[model samples]
Target chain A: MDAASAAIVAKPASVDGLLDLASRDMAGVDALIRDRMQSEVPVIPALAEHLIGGSAKRLRPLLTIAAARLAGAKDDACLRLAASVEFIHTATLLHDDVVDSSELRRGKVAAHLIWGAPASVLVGDFLFARSFELMVEAGSMQALEILARASRVIAEGEVMQLTRSHDLNLPQDLYLEIIGAKTAELFAAAAEAGAVSAGATPEQQKNLRRFGKNLGLAFQLVDDALDYSGEAGTLGKNAGDDFREGKATLPLLLAIARTGPSEKAFWDRAVARREQEEGDFEKARRLIAETGAETATLELAARYADDAKAALAAFSSSNSWRPAMEELADFAVQRKM
Target chain B: MDAASAAIVAKPASVDGLLDLASRDMAGVDALIRDRMQSEVPVIPALAEHLIGGSAKRLRPLLTIAAARLAGAKDDACLRLAASVEFIHTATLLHDDVVDSSELRRGKVAAHLIWGAPASVLVGDFLFARSFELMVEAGSMQALEILARASRVIAEGEVMQLTRSHDLNLPQDLYLEIIGAKTAELFAAAAEAGAVSAGATPEQQKNLRRFGKNLGLAFQLVDDALDYSGEAGTLGKNAGDDFREGKATLPLLLAIARTGPSEKAFWDRAVARREQEEGDFEKARRLIAETGAETATLELAARYADDAKAALAAFSSSNSWRPAMEELADFAVQRKM
Candidate 1:
C-alpha cells in the first residue's frame, strides 16, 4: 500500500479525526473527478465544475469510504468506488432538474437554466455513461449489478412520483416505497459496494447495507418533513416547495388523512390548484400542526433513525465504523437543511 | 426446444424468399411489441402504442432476426432480442423528441406535445429501464455488453451533436463520426446480438455486424441528403430542415466546400440565421444543386451501400441471408423519405 492508504488504515480517535480522514481520502477522488469532467464543449466543464465544485456534504462517498475502512480494507480501488457513487449521484441530479423543470438547485440556477435543456440532458447522460465505465474498471460484476439495479430503481421511483403527482389519495405505503427505491437504494448500494470491495463476509455486507438503507429512509423522511417545517432561509428555499408543486409528500398525506370536513375543502383546493395565497401558506401550516402530521412525520423519521442505529449492533464494539454510523443517523434528522 | 422455438425456426423458410423474410419476421415481433407495451398509465400505453404502431419499417429488429437466421441459429431468443432492440429504439426516440423540442415526428405531434414534457421524459426513462430488465432476462453477459456499449455510443453521439450545434465549421469526418456513433452503433449491435444469441462463430458475427453498421450509415446519409432535396409533402417535413436547424449534415458541408463567393455568403447567412425566408431557401437550394453537392452526397451514400453489400460476401451465395442483406443495402438508399 502507498503512503495515503497506510495513513487511511490508521484509526481515527475522534469525530475531528474521522473528518480529517474523510477529507484526505475524498481529495484523491475529487481530483480524479475534476480531471475526467473536462470537455471541449465550453458549457460542460463550466456546469460540471460549478455543480461538482459547489458545496456538497459528501455524505454518500464518506459512507462508502468509512464502511470500507471499517471492514479493514484500505485500497485505491475503494477510493475509485467511492468516487463512482458521487458521479452517479451528480448525474441523477442533472436529469432530475431537467425532468422537474427545476430552476433552482442548491440555491443556484440549475444547469438546465444556464445551459439549455438539451445540453443538460445530454451531459447528464454523459456522466451516467462515464460512471458505468468507471465501475467496469473496478472489475466487479457484483458491484455493477448493485449499481445497475439501483439506477433502475431510481428511474422507476421517479416515474412513480410522476404518476402520483397531485393525487391527494397517495397511500403512505406507496410514498414510502417510492422513497425507498429512489433514495435508500442508492445509499444501500454505496455501503454494500464498499463492504463487498473490502471483502467483508456476506453477513457483514448485509448489515452494512441495512444500516445505509435505514439511514437513507430517515434522511428522506426528514427532508419531506422539513419541506413543511424548515426555515426557508436555512433550507435555501421556501418551505412547502413540495406542497406548492402539488407533491403528495409524507406531511401532506398524513395531514389530509387526519383533517376534518371543514379543512378538507381547503386541502382539496390547495392540492388541486397547487397554489397558495398570501395567507394560504400559513393556514396550511396551521392545519398540518393541528392535525398532528408534523409530529407523526418526525416520529417516523426517528423510528427509521433508531432502526439505522440498531443495524450497527451486528458489528462488534471494537469496530470504528460504529460511531460514524451513529453520527450519520444523527445527521439524518438533525441537519438544518 | 419448445413449440414456440420450433415455430420461430420453421416460419422464416415459408416466407417466400430472403427479401420477404424481413416483413414476415417483423410481423411476429410487432405483435409481441404491441402486446407487451400495455401500461397502467393511460398516457404511457397511448403514446407508446401510437409511436411503435407507426410506420417504422422495423429495420433494426429485422436486422437482428435476419442476422440470426443467417447464422443458422433459430430459437425464441431471437424474438426476445428483436423486441429488445425495438424497445430501446423507441425509448431513445421518446427521449430525443424532448431533447430536440421537436414538434413533429413521423408526421404527428410528438409525445411531449401530447402529454407534456415531464411525462414524456419520465416515461422515456421508464422504457430505458425496462429495456435493461428485458435484456437481463436474455441472460447473456456478452449481449448485455453489446447493448450497454451501444447505449453509451448513442449518448456520446448526442453530446457531440449538442456541442456541434450551429457550428458551421464542423468537418465531414466529424459528421460521419457522430452519425456512426448515433445511428450505426445500435444497428450493428442489433445484428451482432442476433448472431451472439444464435451461437454464431466470432468471424460470422463480426461480418453481420459490419453489414448492419454500413447499412445504417448509408441509410442516415440518404436521409440527411433528402432533408435538402426531397419534396416536403413526400418526406413528411419541409426540405432543408437540417440547414434551418444549422445542422452541419453532409450535403451542406459539401455545398459550403464547393460554392463560389456569393453562394458562400448566402450559405453563411442561411445557416447562421437557421430559419430562412423563402428566397433564402431557394437561393441556398440552387447553389447546392449548382455545385453538385447533392450528387456528391448521393455518391457517398451509394458507396456505403456498396460497402454494406460487400460485407455479406463472407456468407455463402446459397445462404438465405445473403439476398436479404443485399435487399437491405438497396432499401437503405431507395426510400423516398
Candidate 2:
C-alpha cells in the first residue's frame, strides 16, 4: 500500500492489448457478473438484466483483473472484486439516469424511462447493497472501506454537479473536483481494491490507485469533450446531452470564455434556459470547434493518460501488465468512447 | 449469550419501560448521529436534515444500543452501529417518499416535494454509502455482513411490494414475507449486529436476531393496522396513506376476506385504480371495523410481540434488559405510532 502517492505513467499503450492480455480473467468476471445479478424476484432480474446486460464495459473489471495480475495473485478474489466494481458502476448509472432525467443509456432507453424511476432507484439500491456483500465476501476490510468511501464521494459529486448545473461561471477547479469525485473515485478505488485483494505491497497498491485515478480522469475528460464532438458515437450515446441537460461541461465553459457578447448570449439562452432553438446544437458545436475546445479537451486527456501510464514506472516494463495498462490509458483518450 | 433460543417472555410488557431503560444510551446514539450526518455538500446535509431532523423515533437506534447492552458490551462500537442503523432507515425513508410520490412525511412535506426527486434520490444514496462506511468503522465484519445482507433484503422486499401492487388476492404468507423482508430484516440485523459488537456468543446473537425479527414483524403489523386506525396520530404521518397508495396492507387484506360481492367490487375499484372517491375512506373504515379487521391485525401483532419477548427468556428474568425488551415488544402493537 506504500505507493499511495506515486504519480507517473508512460507513453500511449494499446487498449486492445490490455483486454487481450487478460481475456481469460475478463471472461470469468463476466460469468460471475451474470450469475450474481440474478434475483428470485422476477422484476429484479428483469430490470437488472436490462441495465447490466446491455453494457460490455470490460474496462473497470479489466482494470481490477489486470491489477491483480500485476500483483502476481493466484487467488480469484480479483474476479469478485471486479464484478463488484461493475455492479457499483451499473447501480450509479441507474440512479444517475433518474437524477439527470436521461432518456438514453448506452444507446438504449434508460432504465428509468422503461421501468419508471421507482424501480430504477430501488434496484440501484439492491445492486449497491449486493456490491457490499461481495466486498465482505472478498474478506478485505480495507477494500470495503475504500469502495464505500468512493461510493459516498460519487454521490456527493453527483449532488455537486446537480447544484452547479447551468452556471456558466462555474469554476474550473470545482468542475474538476466534481468529475474527480463522481468518476475517478470509483476508478481509483477499483484499482486500489484489486491491489489489496492480491495482497500487493502498499507501494504497489498506491501506484495502482494513481494509475486508475489518472486513467479515469482522462476518460471522463474525453467523455465531456465527446458530448460536444457531435459525432461522439461512444456507447451510442447522442451528443449535446450535457447541453440539453443544462450541464456546464468543459467545452461550453472553454468556448464561453472566448465568446463575444452575441455568442455569450447564445450560450446563455441555450444553456441557462435549457432551451435549444433549432440548429442551436449545430451552432454550439461550431462555436466550440472555433475555440479549439475539443483539441484542448483531448490534449488534457492525453496528459492525464500519460500520468496514468507513468504511475507504473516502478513495475518492470518487462511485466506485460504494466505495458498493457499504459496502452489502456492511451485508449482512455483516443477511443470514441 | 445464553439467551439464544430461549423462549419465556411473560405477558405483554410496558413499552415505555424499554424506552426509559435505554434513555441515556439513546442520547449517546442521537449525538453520534448528529455528528455523522453532516456533509460538506450543503445540499446533502440540507436535504438530509429536512428528512431525519424533522421528527425523531430514536427507536431503531434504541434497539441496537439496547441489544448491545444485553450482551454487556463495553466498547463504543454499539453506538456507531446504532447510528449506522438509523442512517439506513432514514435513507430508505427518503427513497420511499420518492417511490410512493408521497406528498408528506413525518406530518410535513416530503423532501422530494421540497428539494425535488433528484436531490432526494441522490442524497439517499449518499446516506446509504455513508452507512456502509460506518459499518466498516464499527470494526466488526459480522456486523457489517449482517447489515449489508439486511439492506439487500429490504430492497428486495420493496421491489416485491411494487410488483405485488394492486393484487387484492396477494397471498397472506407472501404478504408476511414482504413485510418481514422490508421491515423486519433491518430490525433483526440491528439487534444481531449489536450482539455481535458486544462479542456475544453465536447463540446469544441468534437469540437477539430472533427477538428483533419478531418485534419488527409485530411493529409492522401494527403499522399496517394503524394505516386504517383513522386517528393513528403517531409521528404525525397521515393515516389512510396505504389505502390511498393502494398498498395491500394487512387490514385491507383481512377486511376484504369478510366482504360480500358488492363490498368486493367496491374494494376492486378503490384499491386497484388507486383512485379514491369522496367518502371512500370512511366506507373502507366502516367495513374494516365491522369485519373486526383492526382487532385481528392487533391480535396477530400481539402474537409476534410475544414471540419477540419470549426470545429473550434465556437472559434471566433478573436481567433488567430482558424485562424492558419484553415490555418493548408489548409496545410494538400498543403505541399510537
Best by TM-score: 2
Per-residue CA lDDT of model 1 for A188-266, tens digit only, reads 8888888888888898889889888988898888888888888876775457778778888888888888886767788
RMSD of each predicted structure? 7.7, 4.6
| The best candidate in terms of lDDT | 2
lDDT of 1: 0.75
Q: What TM-score would chain A of each candidate receive against the reference chain A?
A: 0.91, 0.94
Worst 10 residues of 2 chain A by lDDT: A1-10
Model 2: per-residue Cα lDDT over B1-337, one tens digit each:
1121122233434557877877878777778777877888999988887777847676777889889998888888898999999999989999998999887687778899988999999999999998999998898888999999999999999999988977888888999999999999999999999999999989999999999999999999988887787473565677888899999988898888888676877998899886689999888988988898888888888889889878898887887888788778877777776
Candidate 1 lDDT, B119-183, residue by residue in tens: 77666655655565556556666776787678767877877887785677788898999899879
For model 2, the local distance difference test gives: 0.85
